[model samples]
Target: MPRDHSHDPGHHHGHAHSHGPATPHPAQPAPWSILRMTVTARLAAALAVSAGLWVVVLVAMR
Candidate 1:
């Protein structure tokens, strides 16, 4: 049986795409900061959220 993908862009009719990785890797390598906890994006986002909450609380008190 043959998979006819002549009308599609993602899937090929032949098994040509199998020569590459099953999925394309990210364009950019993961940063060293992301590999550590203290400098990770999640920690930065959390700190930003905590600072925003403090600002809201200060405004309410005023």
Candidate 2:
């Protein structure tokens, strides 16, 4: 008689088992959310300033 190895705890048959839909964490901003927002705002402001300067130079050159 051969022992069945499929049900062995140490065997991994590359099968996925879904517990259920993932549950969302508590409604709270991530620790880095503020830093991300600040960096985004700074980048946007820098781009806006750069565009304004380029427009000024172009208009002056014309």
By lDDT, the best candidate is 2
Per-residue error for 22 in candidate 2, Å, reads 63
Candidate 1, pairs of clashing residues:
none
Per-residue alpha-carbon lDDT of candidate 1 for residues 7-43, written as tens digits (9 for 90 to 100): 6667655556544567784466666554466556777
**Candidate 1, position 2, lDDT:** 96
The deviation in Å at residue 14 for candidate 1 is 32
Tens-place lDDT digits, model 2, residues 1-62: 99999888678768654443375544666676535677778899789999999999999999
lDDT of prediction 2: 0.76
lDDT of each candidate versus the true structure? 0.73, 0.76
lDDT of 1 at 35: 49
The TM-score of candidate 1 is 0.38
Using TM-score as the measure, the top candidate is 2
Tell me how far the alpha carbon of residue 3 in candidate 2 is from the true structure, in angstroms, after superposition.
99
Stretches off by above 4 angstroms in model 1 are 1-39
Q: Candidate 1: what lDDT?
A: 0.73
